[model samples]
Target: MNRIALAVCALALIVAACAGSREEVVEEFLPSLESTTTTAANGDLPSTTTTRPAEDQQIDELIAGLADQVREIRGLPLALPPLEFVPGDQLEERYQALNGLKSIGSTRINEAYLQALGVLPEGDSAADLVSFCSLPGFFDPESATLVLREGLADLTPYGRRLLFDELAGAATNEAHDWWGTMASLERSGNTEAAVGLWALVQGDAAFHAEQYVAESLDSTDQFAIRLEEIACQQESTSPP
Candidate 1:
């Protein structure tokens, strides 16, 4: 290559190294739902108070942060439209029960998201299977951690952190910012590379993704070769 061309390529690589994209950031950080605090009007001014204990309030704020994260997902680009068209404000209604998190409590929230995500999209909307595939902690492509984004309104920061900890460290890095990068690939019809990321997931099951894999992959040479490669690598890496 010519000098100017080489310099240009070098600069492009440098730029790529310096910049962090949204998905890369998502993969790297488990965001806390930001907390809000109140201050007295003026040092001497008095403030109204509630009967709830200080710890209850603190716990409440922690849960609020998690709810904020769940709400943010609605703003992200979907892998596909929801199983059926849902109005924007009412989207949370699909995975959670009414009255917000009050009814479900802390214990059942994760299971709710898992059950919802594992079910197939049925008939025409079947391709929507990958819609929930990149949820940060819940969909661990490495260890095959289980869970989803919806039904998070009830989860405390501790609960959210537990799920975040379950994520396979290898899957949530610059090289595998699957949500933004892989989702786009899937949208563009690059099914092979997109689903191939699932190979990073350890367990045999992959919620709704299994439907797409089973229905799409026939006894074709290319698909078979790819799966065999995944299996071989997994076995070779298995510890003694």
Candidate 2:
């Protein structure tokens, strides 16, 4: 499948939080990365809370919003891969092909997204990674597994700041370190979650309201390239 389809599957599976087999060490240490701070704890942090109800439709929209942000960074137009719409004769085969996916319900997906993306109901001392982002809780065993397997828990506290806080400044190298980690998430030829994670790496401050990174990259490819290089030191590390 093409990268865009890979990305959609990644996002769908991301609700259950799986990456690839390769293990990597976080290359740099930013102090305070381990501290679990809430937006309530720091008024300066962008509020993860939204006025919208923390329900499925709202949360799905929010998750989609983040996913769109990553695709913009990678210069991907919003489109699913061709294979997603299997022929009628092949439908059951495709369903069985996708059966290995973990059975995380939509409500759980919404809750994890709300917590990971919005920093809600905050009181836990330790955090669990539900996607490329982290949430504080032992609420689900699968989520805990995802945290350790993805090394989401192991990333710098600055990572938590970047993924959840919405506007923390990370050096160009720091950002790419994140980019590399995200790229590692694709498996079963799926890369959707990595796309969303890329957006989390690029801070919200980089965009104006209603603007997208794709449009910006179209105008200045070098600028985006420089940002990735500064962040990860790799040449041409495009997001899925």
Candidate 3:
């Protein structure tokens, strides 16, 4: 009888230990296992923002300046050190530091990455610019001058005229400029290279022009016609 009772007691102890183990697991993991949801800005997935104390902001500026010096010494382009190099938890702070160094411009940021990615076309350029790319987001082959043209209402007449002159002379520096070079190459019957550049410019312009139309009440189809003209030129000149 004692042997049987001892066996029952061992079984009871095993059941008790299992119950305690389950209880411990519940206590340890239940809080973290609660469901979580994220708040999105427009259609984009939630992004984290890092806020900087005033002193840290100054330090970041200094570090960025030092980084610029190092880049210049190596004969690299004058732009911000990549994000991985920046010291910050806040994405905005890092972006700002990078922006201060590169000055790559808002148009490249807004119309290039976010809108092109279709996440937030209306995203602020100053907010989202990056340095370099494992996959490059966008390339604005148009110079600052060409961007000033097309009577798009955002640029001055003098600017537009200046860009037109640059566009005309682009054939000479065709090596450095894509759109201008492509157009020139097309004139010279280098249809393949022209097609490549045309694809890029047309893709970017199609997105931006559509964005501009959607955002503004302005009925100006000026940009649309320009895009259409470029597309038609590409199709006509492309060698099938």
Total backbone collisions for each predicted model: 2, 13, 1
lDDT tens readout by residue for model 2, 1-240: 111222333344434333332211211211222232222111111122223233424323332343344343422222211111223333333222222213222111222343353433444211122122122111011111101111112323223212222212122222334434543554333333443443332323233211433342253553643353344422223454
Name the TM-score of candidate 3.
0.19
Tens digit of per-residue lDDT, candidate 3, span 1-240: 011222232233223323333334323322322221221121111111233333434323433333333222222222231212222233234323322322432211213322333433354552332221111011123422111111122322222222222222221123234445545655775443333333333332233323333443144454644444455445444675
lDDT of each candidate versus the true structure: 0.29, 0.28, 0.29
Number of the candidate with higher TM-score, 1 or 3:
1
Task: Give model 3's clash tally.
Answer: 1
Comparison by TM-score, 1 against 2, better one: 1
TM-score of each prediction: 0.23, 0.18, 0.19
The better candidate by lDDT, 2 or 3, is 3
Task: Specify the highest-lDDT model's number.
Answer: 3
User: Where does candidate 3 stray beyond 4 Å?
Assistant: 1-177, 180-190, 218-240
RMSD of 1: 20.5
**Candidate 3 residue pairs that clash:** 50-90
Question: Ten consecutive residues with minimal summed lDDT in candidate 2?
Answer: 137-146
Q: What is the lDDT of residue 44 in candidate 1?
A: 17
Q: RMSDs, each prediction? A: 20.5, 20.5, 28.5
